[model samples]
Target: MKRVVFNQKGGVGKTSITCNLAAISAARGLRTLVVDLDVQGNTTHYLVGEIDADAFPAEAQGAAGLFKQTVGSRKMHQNPDSFVWETPWENLFLLPSSPVLTQLERELESRYKIYKLRDALQKLDAEYDRVYIDTPPNFNFYSKSALIAADTVLVPFDCDSFARQSLYSLMDNIAELQEDHNPDLAVEGIVINQFNSQARLPGELVAELEAEGYPVCATYLSASVKMRESHHEHRPLVDLAPSHKLTQQFLALYDELESGRA
Candidate 1:
């Protein structure tokens, strides 16, 4: 299955969720590929440490290369798999993000290459058991392409009042995208991230969302300093601190998603 972890709001744990979930999937023995479309490259850094810019050309590396190949005379010559990079983890692969994505966006949009990602991923259906896409924080060219390519979208909610208000606008945007671009795309669930059980506001906000009929997943990810340590170590929680509470919550969330698929 192809799943895109998306949110128009930053600091919502999109990178952490995307990388950790893909890591869990890989650990479970699925051939998982993570496509990072965010130019910030947080997902790339999380999976693979800082890349040497001089080692490769922007137009020939990672997601930028994949999208770059879609335009001009270079189109369709390279296999989509050729752009993928291997991470340190077994069964976990990455199509790392590059800063050049910002430069290529206008040309890609002007050429109407929104469906290129979907087409490429379809061709790769046999090569991977699961595909997780990490998108930019805005509903821009990259995020829209990811939404168009994905089978479902997992939204991250940070349990803030401002985030709650933003959720409405985010839902509306997804609804519009579903109507216009990807009719088959589904909202897998709203993952409640950084939940503090001792806090009254978090519970109240979650109750409000559930009462309003949102698809809130039962597994809530708690905030922990270990997550930062995992990031600093450039390791996913499943590999860094599998027995930690946050890691267990991630495992439960992963199981919930797999069960839903089943």
Candidate 2:
């Protein structure tokens, strides 16, 4: 299953959801590949603490070198093994991104680019049980490419009025992509992140979203200091503190996501 965790709004925990889900899938021994479509490289930086390095795992390095092909390079369309590499985690790989990925629009403007990413990914020899795509916060080419390639999408929300409304925008974009580009895509569910149960607003928004036909995940990521610390320290929260509240919440969400795939 190829799953993309996306929101057109920043600060909605898209990276947090992407990395944690990839980490959990690796823990389960699935050869999981995460494509860092976000040019910010937050997912790449969060996993490895940096993006530019000579000595990356095979999968990680492979992922980074992928977009370097000029979209029409003679080297383009090489086997996934040629560009896909390993990260620090077992069974988890990344297509790492650099500042250069931000130039994809300028780079791929001329090549017969109909569903380019989908075509490229379909050529890969790898058999990942799951592929998670981390998309930038917009309905641009990068994100639309991911949406077209993905079998399912997990929309991440921050539990706010505007944030929830952003889901409408995202849904509309998804509708457009499915009609014009990919017809097999489906929305898996909505993931509510960075919640504060003590606040009345989160509770209210959850109900409102559910009423609007979104299957809300039972697990909600908490607004925790440990999660912030994990980002600073560059470790999964489960590795940092398995007993922490946020860690357990992520684990629950992971379980829900995995079960959905099953």
Give each prediction's root-mean-square deviation over alpha carbons: 1.1, 2.9
Tens digit of per-residue lDDT, candidate 1, span 41-123: 99999889889888978778999999998899845778999999999999999999999999999999999999999998998
Per-model TM-score, in order, reads: 0.98, 0.90
lDDT of 2 by residue, 99-208 (tens): 65665555554553447677667765357778899989987767887898889899888999999777887888888888988899988888888888899999999999
The pairs that clash in candidate 2 are: 58-85, 58-86, 59-85, 59-86, 60-85, 60-86, 62-83, 63-95, 63-96, 64-96
Model number with the top TM-score: 1
Worst 10 residues of 1 by lDDT: 69-78
Show model 2 residue runs off by greater than 4 Å: 52-64, 73-77, 109-114
Superposed Cα deviation of residue 160, candidate 1 (Å):
0.5
Best by lDDT: 1
Look at candidate 2 and tell me the lDDT of residue 43.
Answer: 80
